[model samples]
Target: MTAVPQPTAALLDGTALARELTARTAESAAELRRRTGTAPCLATVLVGADPASVTYVRMKQNSCAKAGIESRHVALPAEISTAGLVDAVTALSEDPAVHGILLQHPVGAHIDERAAFEAIAPGKDVDGVTTASFAAMSFGLPGFVSCTPGGIMRLLDAYDVELSGRHAVVVGRSPILGKPAGMLLLARDATVTYCHSRTADLRAHLREADLVVAAVGRPRFIRGEDLKPGVVVVDAGYNEGNVGDVDFDSAAARASLITPVPGGVGPMTIAVLLEQTVEAAWRQLVS
Candidate 1:
């Protein structure tokens, strides 16, 4: 009888780590409320009623509740002008009661999303979508980080991944996810290579990477055969039917460590958002 192949990689187990982090955030939130009598509040602004975006916002709000944080939501029409959206976010940013501001992405193709993000006060930019936040991430300043990338860092740390001097390949260039992720890796002294749809001979890059961050957004875009043996894989994509950018089944056979699609990066993203919101509140209320 033929023996079934076993997965060689250790699971990153983001769900378990997120739970621990969220519990600690809850303790921090409780302490803040006890000391300042103010609950950490996050204001979430959704431009359109895109089902996925709405669902993501709801998930973050639910996480806030679990972490003892307050949440305020604003749902705007799909056709709202960029200026109008900016005004909405600016109002939230200026409000003392709102500790953090989250403007959901893909805010209508016509609207200037960057303008709206800039409207958020740098102090209250807990979602970390603003240029100021990106600069902070690149420079390692004392500021909030892009939630998913922050979570990815936390995941790597939890697994004791040695990043310094490693050849890291990031397969995406989205400003929020891919770019900042690479910048953070570079800040840690990793040699980073970026790949996208137009990149030539992508497989050559993957084979040289000690760590691979798959944020390309395409389901199963990175095949197992293309990866180096014992490479660490972080699948940051969340496609339909709980798929990820990397082919998990095949990649697990060769990876040293890998994150699962649903229980991996997804949970950690919200966890980091909640933690940052609470931190923003503490800084605002106490300092």
Candidate 2:
């Protein structure tokens, strides 16, 4: 008899799921527009001319158009002071025409990122970067979630992955991504453990995880050897050259379900953003 190779893990196809979600959001947007003459508007704030940031903003704008949402952009010079950035964001928050506000991350080292984020009204913080939003998410209250973390949960649900009472190890602690991810998992009754760069004995944690969320922003930081068999992996990192935080090939070999880099978490993030923008608009325009 010929030898047969063991099957690899199933792909968590975020692209297909995102398309479905976007279509649903577009329908809601159209209905909202039919009821009221105004369409949903999302304001995007970009600082400097960073290539990666520019590309991300463009992608989001394009997605907005497809989903029947209007996009307003504010471009600030690289040398803009923290107070100046805050003033710009505050203006958007006060604008009745803008339903949701998205401030691109890493504005500048010289700028007060937190202050700029705080300037966005709690209701208009569609990107979910404000402390209010974070608190809401942590407490499982009704609020917009951080986009990438929201996407990860949707992906897990789409595949029918069980989270309750399972050990979920998140291998990063970014305010928006990793921290919120762990909290969301915890809300679902999953036992959550967070590990960061300075954490001691990282592999030991991975060995026990039933679910692993890789958001460390390092390419191939988590190896297959570290993961126990049949674990679920969500690679939320997008590094240079389209690589993810996990070594996909190696991790897939061990994982029962895994998300790919470009097609996995990327599309879902935009989908969730568009969804939240339309929802925000509906709230502001309808009731």
Candidate 3:
């Protein structure tokens, strides 16, 4: 008798989950509109003319439209000073009409990115990049989370992945994705470990993980050989052409569950953005 090949692991299918979330967000936005006669608005700020950043912002705006949210775009020149960028964001933070503010990352070498992020008021920091947002994430409070991390949590919940006591190793330590992702996992009672470029024997750390999140931004950084069989893998890296950090061809063979690049974490990020915008609007109306 011929030996049969093992079945491939199930795909996490973030696109489907994002669609569901968008529908729910639309309903919430509609209700908010009925109550206050104004829809939630998101101000998207893009510095420099990085094509990738431009495309990402456009995608976000389209998602907002689909979810019944309004988006305002602010494009600043590449040479814009840090102080100028901060002033622009601060203006948006004070704009009563804008419920959320999203400043695209890597705002050019000349700008102080953290300062610009901090300029967004906590109430309107729906992108969750502020110091206040980080504190809220660490404490598991009811506040907007970093979009990609928030989306990863939503994806895991959709697949009914049990997080309690599981060893989740997140490879990366960036404030937005990696660090925040680990904290969210911990919030769900998962035993979380954070690793980065400086981590010694990275493969050893991954081998012990029951769950792995690759957000290092390096294409194919996590190999299948490094993974523990039956592990749940989430690929949140978005490189050129929708490439992921994991070696999907190999990692998929070993993982029990895995998210794809383009259709995976990508769509979910925008979904969370729109959802949070609506939430901000509701809170503003109530308060």
Using lDDT as the measure, the top candidate is 2
* lDDT string, candidate 2, 26-128, tens digits: 9999999999999999999999999999999999999999999999999999999999999999999999999999999989999999999999998898988
Error of 2 at 249 (Å): 0.7
User: Could you estimate the TM-score for every candidate?
Assistant: 0.97, 0.97, 0.96
Query: What CA root-mean-square deviation does each model show from the true structure?
Result: 1.4, 2.2, 2.1
Residue 226 CA error for candidate 1 (Å)? Answer: 0.8
Better of 1 and 3 by TM-score: 1
Better of 1 and 2 by lDDT: 2
Q: Residues 189-231, candidate 1, lDDT per residue (tens digit)?
A: 9999999999999999999989999999899999888898999
User: Ten consecutive residues with minimal summed lDDT in candidate 3?
Assistant: 2-11
Question: Against the unseen true structure, what C-alpha lDDT does each candidate score?
Answer: 0.93, 0.94, 0.91
**What value does the lDDT take at residue 74 in candidate 1?**
97
Predicted structure 3, TM vs. truth: 0.96
Q: How far off is residue 53 in model 2, in Å?
A: 0.3
Residue 158 miss distance in model 2 (angstroms): 0.7
